[model samples]
Target: METGIRDIVLKWTAVVVAATWIIGCGGSATKPSPPPPAFPKAPAKKPSVTSPKKATQRPYKVGRNWYQPIPHAHGFTQKGIASWYGKKFHGRKTSNGEIYNMYAVTAAHKTLPMDTWVRVKNLDNNRSIDVRINDRGPFVRGRIIDLSYSAAKRIDMVGAGTARVEIFALGAAASGEPSSKRPPAFVPVDYNKGNFTFQVGAFKERKNAERLRQALDRRYKNAHISEYDSPDGLFFRVRVGRITDLAQAEAYEQILIEDGFNQAFIVAE
Candidate 1:
């Protein structure tokens, strides 16, 4: 009886150990589904880029005064005292980037656009000169334009330093009109023996002066060569279009400048 009891206990013990072993092997084979396949991390995002802004055209102030550059200077005119500059500023870069030549027929204005053509009339003596606006200046109160040395000399204002002047804007066409509208044709007037004339060129050689006179004669009603005896030496001067009226001479002076005779200046006979 004892032996049978012992055999029954051993059989039950063997069955419990086999069942535990089977459960352990099944848990090891499953492996927790390989940690759910480890989903790939999302990619990092990048930044965006942009462009720069443009400059604005706005009115600005300078010193104790305010200045607004006229959007369009066409037909703009002003009258005030005119002064001049010379050797001190020569060969320096102008406000418009041009090398300032005090001898050139150019001027500076507080507000006129660069390259503007202006006829400046000296109210004191009724003398006039044509100048191209290429710089900005005369910041002093009551001053309007700053004339180049040669331009001021033409109007007989060099000795006076400053003079009351009338500035007329030219080549500024009326809005909607062609910029190239033909200027009025020059009228031929009776040559006054004592009238003032424009000297387009002066040459030591008479033949050279004659060649310029011939060129001017074709375009002008009257062109002549005159002998000038100066302290420097004798020179042949080519003069064109005699006029007694200073205003008329100014008009002709502008025409001569536009025709590329930039050195042309008024000479009183």
Candidate 2:
């Protein structure tokens, strides 16, 4: 009976040891604890940057002359002979790419920046006009400013062609408060009262005159070809718009110049 009891105890001990070994091997094969529950990676960061500002002023040249426009022209002042340009340059482009308008209060300067507003006083007559500088010119020596035909008329320089004048720069229009006053109205002249017209082009060849007339007709009203017998020879004149007064004629001339007819001028009927 004692031998049988001892054998039963040994069997139970062997069973317990085998069960412990099985549990240890199963836990070791548990997929390495699921790789510690993998997490997503973060994105990389980028650096910031900035750019430099552009320059506002630049130097330029025309013909034999070099010019450096003033970047800032406020408070600038000058005194010299101011000449007037009419029908000859009436319908042309200004230095600033604007259509030249002789009727508008505008002028041209050599060194003053474009779009500058200036007060011009005719020293001879004490007449003053406010003009915007929209072109570069008076390339002629001894001349300081080139006034538009209308500007010249304001200062009574139309008969003289030029006048001694004083000019004061008032800065850019954008930099100052806008004027509330309306611009001067263009007074129309009665066709029956006077004989005036804008001669846009003159050609010795009738065919050339006809071509210009056709071009002008497409862009302007009342464009026509008129024949003129000059001492040199017969010439064809391409005229546009009849006017009754010199002021009205000059205004039409300005329109032609802006249209690329640089030789356009006023003529009496």
Candidate 3:
């Protein structure tokens, strides 16, 4: 009798356990899984900003020829054939790596340092305009400068195709010392006094100057290489015969020219 009662108790206990499990599972299903484990949303993206590339004022090559830019534009003046380039070079990368804009008041020079501002005066009409040097070109013989379309138009040279213009470098574009009301009077370069030397060659490579210096030291007295730290890079200027007066330097320069160093020039030391 006891065993039968125990069997009935066991069945009742099983039914109760099954009902509790089913009810517990049903409650869990209705509870919604803790919102699927929420994650923090990413921050909104910001617009990207791009900066202009810095210009390099180093020596560059065109065709088989190489040209070195001048270190400074102080007391710089030149009279040359000025030509303008428009659609052909518009939106192109210039020598200094700047985008070319035909309408901008900019110009190109074969040897002038980049960012130099110069006043271009047309010799024919006496019209003048100021332009900043940002490129390098007009590589043709006898052409001194290349102007932008608008710069050439302002100087009354667009119709002429080429104009004889005198360019006087005012200063660097960043220099705000010059008066905008009146053009600054140009002071001619002094070539009389001060110690001077004959610069026979300038090379971007130090070894090239070293080889020349070694050859010069054997033949020419006081031949040495002077280093110049330009904005673009270091330059090795091969010079000879340091003199106190400009006249002696000029005399030595002629001698260097006669010795097959035709591009030799006198530079004040």
Candidate 4:
């Protein structure tokens, strides 16, 4: 009976030892440790922001027509009908590739170099305002400048659809120069030297251009034909006179206009 008791005790002790070994080894015995508490992921970084780029001024196209802007605003002055545009072109892209702002003190000129600062005086009321040229326009035959709504209002020309005005170029606002509020003294364009010509006409046919040029050469002396390869095709332009000074060119242009060359306009060669 005592030997049977000893064997039963030994079997119990063996069972206890096996269970202790399994627990110490960290086997599937201890509720499988809660999969190492998950760590929260770090927040993602945001992209950096940068400022918009400034636009550049260059030759541009409008309504299937190409316009070559002058190089500078040296001594530019003119007297003609001035008009204003507002909501219709407020957000459109200007000739200089800038967004149009109707309320800004800006203006459009057919050929004045972009970024030129011009002072406009309303002859009717003597009201004046300084505006920067940022686009091209006033496309109308007698219109010489197109002002922004705010610019027109400053000159008291908003009530009138158009106003007779005198414009004087102040050139690009440079350091040590007078500010727009106080424009520098008006300097008349009296260039003693420059290659200036008058573009009288452009023709698709070289023969027609040559004939006109030959006729002009008899009286104008320096009349010639220039060929241009436009996007539409090739064109021959008839130009007359090679003069020095814009003043002389302007006077000559008037004479040509009276002589039936109504389409003549001054151009820097």
Compute the lDDT for candidate 3: 0.64
Which window of ten consecutive residues has the lowest lDDT sum in model 1? 14-23
Q: Is candidate 3 or candidate 4 better by TM-score?
A: 4
Question: What is the lDDT, from 0 to 100, of the residue 21 in candidate 4?
Answer: 8
Q: Compare the candidates by lDDT and give the number of the best one.
A: 4
Candidate 3 global Cα RMSD: 34.1
Q: Between which residue pairs do clashes occur in model 3?
A: none
lDDT of 2 at 194: 53
Candidates arranged by TM-score, highest first: 4, 3, 2, 1
lDDT (Cα, tens digit) per residue for candidate 2, span 167-245: 9876565423332122243123232235665554556899998876786666566678887665556877666766665
Better of 2 and 4 by lDDT: 4
> How well is each residue in 74-180 modelled by candidate 1, as lDDT tens digits?
44567888888876676676766566767668888766655556789999999888777777777776688899887898999877778999998764323343222
**Quick one: how many clashes does candidate 1 have?**
0
Q: Rate the local accuracy (lDDT) of all candidates.
A: 0.59, 0.60, 0.64, 0.64
The residue ranges of model 3 lying beyond 4 angstroms of the native Cα positions read 1-57, 175-212, 219-222, 225-262, 265-269
lDDT of 4 by residue, 52-134 (tens): 12323333445544455654567778999998887667667776666676767889897887667888999999989989877
Clashes of 3: 0
TM-score of each: 0.42, 0.45, 0.58, 0.63
Candidate 1: give the clashing pairs. Answer: none
